[model samples]
Target chain A: MLHEPASQSGPDASADYKMRIGVWMFLLYAAIYAAFVAINLLKPLWMEKTVFLGLNLAVVFGFGLIVFALIEALIYNHMCGTHEADNKGGE
Target chain B: MAIAIFLTFVAAVLGLSFYFAAKTKSASGYFAAGGQIHWGVNGIAFAGDYLSAASFLGICGMIATAGYDGFLYSIGYLAGWIVALFVVAEPMKRLGKYTFTDALDAKFNSRGIKLFAAISTLVVSVFYLIPQMVGAGVLVEPLLGIPHYAGVIMVGAIVITIVATAGMTSTTYVQFIKGAMLVVFSLIVTVAVLVRGLSTEPDQGGRVPFYKYATLEAKEVKGALVVNDYKVLTSVPAKAETYVKLEKGGVQTWWLRSDKDGKIALKETQYEVKKADGSKLVNGLPASKDNVLRQNGGLEAIKGKTGPEAATGKVGPFEFLSILSDPETRINTWKIVKLSDGEDKVVVYAPSVKPGNKMMRPGLKFKTEGTPIQKLDFLSLMLALFLGTAALPHILIRYYTVPSPACARKSTIVAIAAIGFFYVLTMYMGLGAVINAALNPVTDNMSAPLLARTFGTFLFAVISAIAFATVLGTVSGLIIAASGAVAHDLMDRYLQLGHTEKQKVRAGKIAAFVVGIIAILLGILFQGMNVSFLVGLAFAVAASANLPSIIMILFWKKTTAKGIAASIVTGMVSAIGLIMFSPSMYDKFGLNPATAPVPLDNPGIISIPLSFLVLVAVSLLTQKKEASAA
Candidate 1:
């Protein structure tokens, strides 16, 4: 388990760092998701255009969202782990 | 043989539950699985729990019918999990002891918070439970040839046994197994769909052609509706009449029913046998003799080159999508239209041919050109789906089953990965059902399983059995959540019963039994509705009621106990109240739905924002102490 040792970084500082990382990641995802919805509402015709192989713009964008989510999760996990390790080492 | 396979799956799951019962002797184990479940198992269990019948059966059926419109829901649902992973998971695991109510009450320890949060949990769980039970009844009907009520009762009993015996331990294991099975089988079927490719030709052995029948006059006889002059017409104009073909004694006859008034409506048709004595016998074809499943037909090629125009044979996945986007592929889609009655009454599903390119776009199902109210309705549904997943009581409670905050976060990530992959596979499987002609005319929910049946009977049997298990897993989770709200949060803490651990466990088991019975009755009452629609209602409720309270508490320092309690009640009541007076509910009451006060079908676009406003208003009035401390 990843944790900040109490002797080094206090609980409040550790929680603050974790909260910032979580919030940033959430905002990044929300932006991408919101963009997809905006396209559907404002310019639905753009979704019908074929972008890759036989896949249309709507489909490619959807697939992009799923892939982006997985990537973001991995990045968040790794960053949070490294932050916890650095905090523990400071003791 | 299929029945045998189905029963075996049920028996094995039951035996697993009974075995786990021994380990759940303590209150903690019964409610939270002792917080000892491996993160990996719990991750897949989350997928299993979240991917109710709506995900597997409903989405596939929607795609099979409406094309890309159904896949939009997949994006919305998966996106909601991102909120859970980043915002809710770690804090939830750190704060709560067992149920979701425990998490919100962690700061204030107020009885009012506990009372309303528990009530919110129960209402949301019950709302979510009905769809799973209804989907269960639907699956049982086609698989076992039993009545719909019997299937609902069987699922209720099995899920109750699972919850009552081993509680969260058994529920977790069952979800893990079923979730893994659902993903793997969906992948296999999707690959099979790709390999088979697209075809324009109808089945060779059983080619049922179209015919038009003569109009029959209807007259009132003794206050009963009766029709006369039932005969098959040989010839009619091609464009303006309803056509049907009937086969008798290995001979096929074509009949045309004209569009003129008093024309015979082809409600249904069967064979009548004439004996030597000039008497006629009307009866059904025997199931044993006529049991072979038939392939769906009516798909035709609209845009094709001379070579591929004949048939694409076996195309690659990219090639398949490209071909479907071509304008020449005409698909027969079922459309429900209103008749002269003007109300939603006389709803009839008329078959219409749509070009492939149009089907690949959004306007086929959710009309964008309609009035602003219709557009708002679409946005409202999307908003609910995008926000609902994290707020669900059953999904929230799963965070407590893991050992640490890290485990909770890891499990959510794993769930997103697994769920995301399965949702992608659903698009292919749904489209496969469409081109393969696997739709049951009456109910679109049968699309995925029927597509599996086209491969082989054993695959069909396995898919059907797993779908039933899907219902059981989800329903059990919901019941556990509901029972936890009753025995742990409400009765023990709020009511000041202060029950012992042993007493709490006993009370929880009893609560599960009672909730399960209520779910069964509701399932039977709401038969024939599409499972996806019902699940949407549940999501709206969860998003409106629980989400505002959770987000406000986690971020807002000024949030008081009264604010949280008031928001929970306001969100729950407003969403449900709007639904009750909405047009859909009016239709359920056999009243003129157009006369309903609420125009929008989904209440989230209104209720969610209203909840936030109520929370802020209430908190400002009651925030003296909390504000001073901050």
Candidate 2:
């Protein structure tokens, strides 16, 4: 027997669309994150090179990834929200 | 005053838990907070739950001691939330009822899936709990002046009460409070750091100023170097680069050999030794106030600035990083050398001067130019942190507390933003500790708290209480997850014990009590082990055992029950097995690390991929059999 969901809410009508957007976003972020590890591994000295505001590539890139994730999350939420609103009535 | 504040915080948390207990009558209320938590509250709570003692204390301590290498953890950890927000959050909300096992086994009611997933949850939770519990004990001794075991028991009992009384409801609120307080107070500390700016001589609150090394001309008489009428007992031939050990007045200390303009000079170092007789000696003298390793860490000079009182007072965030990146600026960092002096253990806290440009870069703790295996170890750790956050049982279970998939997604975004902001502040807090003479030579875990003490006693008390709350929040969340695995997944579903709602809630409470006790014992048993290392192991285990099955099941249509079950077992066993014999564990076991079979300390690089391959193979093999049966 299939176990029921804990919440009483019905199945989401926009789940497929949301999943499509989510997968794309996941791939994009994973690539960016992978490049960070790759750069540290392959070109270690490159991190020491001064980049922005007298900070090295290591500090700048590290801070950039964190900020980028937040901006991407907000954008993802907004895109999904707009799509859900345009297609199905907002949840 | 700190004790009073801590007691007040504890009382407030207990009161909140008992208040929620009256409303948490059913199993749903106990397990998932009745799916009624507001997205905003749940979002902050997620941050609180996720930022355990490891993130707040361990990472800050690492950065304080090791520089930019520690921030790698903050980056990797926050990166993992991208996976949570974009992939796991919504589906988890839609599928899972109580625990992570609920989501994994939802598609297939196979007893194998239930049993294995529950086991994985419990294993991951228990491993994760050990570090947080140990960190609690570690924090308490310095902050509250209590014994370590007593601190561990106090945290265990309080967390058990919080979980058993109201389960997710109380845990969520506790996490929410902690998360908010942690962020706000860290921001205050960061602002304090920025306002104070860079200083060559930081005020040390009337304590003895940092020990300055004495430079003396190297004079050798009768094959022994003598300084201040004291005989050097062991001289290693004043080479251009080597430290020489000397004894005077029953105290032994190391002196650096420096050759400048064809003139040799010897510089004194601070060293501590623990003798076989259980007596401690500092600077070759019996441990006393007059002779000890003075507070370490400060800037030797600032760029384009002159004089001993040179300071970059009140700089912006960008300027702070910029000033530290100057080529002429030098920061004092301590390097610890552990050696055996006969039957006694000698630990030398040697001061090393590094250019600010190099200090802010990688290679302090994780050597980029190290061996290929060492490089791979860094990769494995990054991969684990990148993939581990979404797979963690306590984190996954939070998705169910929200009402809808959208709420789950929104809450995750909120978590990412709040946690990211706090992580950004960790850089400042760590750098603050590094340049402000705030590090405790004994433990790096106390760096953040000690940095707060540099600001004032009030901020220190508040930060310590919040850090303690951080441990309590995370431990309660882990216990709730583990309890749900046992009471809801194992007992009710896998074994089909057919417990009523009340019985199920009671069982969960009992499980929480037992797990809390186990955590306490492990915490006390594993004292002095690296907290960050234990946390990294948890991340590796979670990423290995859970992520493969989770991603495959959600994305792949051909995933079979056998695939999920086999994948979970393979991933869990492989990760645990590798860790058991890994070089780090070998060192922990008091054996030579080089003799260990596993080269990689983190199992995620190998075991995660292995799990995915096993799942695909098992699924392909069982597809035809399952098709025929259906």
Instruction: Report model 2's TM-score to 2 decimal places.
Output: 0.96
Fraction of true interface contacts that also occur in model 1: 0.35
Model 2, residue B269: what's the lDDT?
68
Could you say which candidate leads in TM-score? Answer: 2
Chain B TM, cand. 2: 0.95
Residues B1-630, candidate 2, lDDT per residue (tens digit)?
Answer: 888888999999999999999999989899999888999999999999999999999999888878888899999999999999888998888888888888888887789999999999999999999999989998999787889999999999999999999999999999999999999999999998998888887774434365455776776568666676656666443213566777667756787767678677887667788989999988877997576566678787898464465787789998898788777888878776676666877777766787877778777778777899889889999999999999999999998898888889999989999999999999999889988888877678888888898877888899999999999999999999999999999999999998889999999999999999999999998887667778989999999899999999899999999999999999999999999999888988889999999998888999999999999999999999877866
Q: Report the Cα lDDT for candidate 1.
A: 0.80
Model 1 over residues B1-630: C-alpha lDDT tens digits? Answer: 789999999999999999999878877889889888889999999999999998888888888888878887788889899889888888777778888888898888899999999999999999988888889999999899998999999999999999999999999999999999999999988888887777665331123332221233433448433444433322223345433434445443333333347444443322233344544333223224253223343366636532235555667767776677667777766544332221211223445667877777666666644677877887888889988998999999898888877778889889999999999988888888877777776678888898888787888899998899899999999999999999988888789786777898999999999999999999999887778878888999999999998888899988898898889999999999999999888988888889999998889999999898999999999888666765
lDDT of 2 at B109: 75
Off by over 4 Å in 2: A89-91, B205-210, B221-223, B235-243, B249-251, B256-264, B288-293, B304-309
Q: What is the lDDT of residue B251 in candidate 2?
A: 58
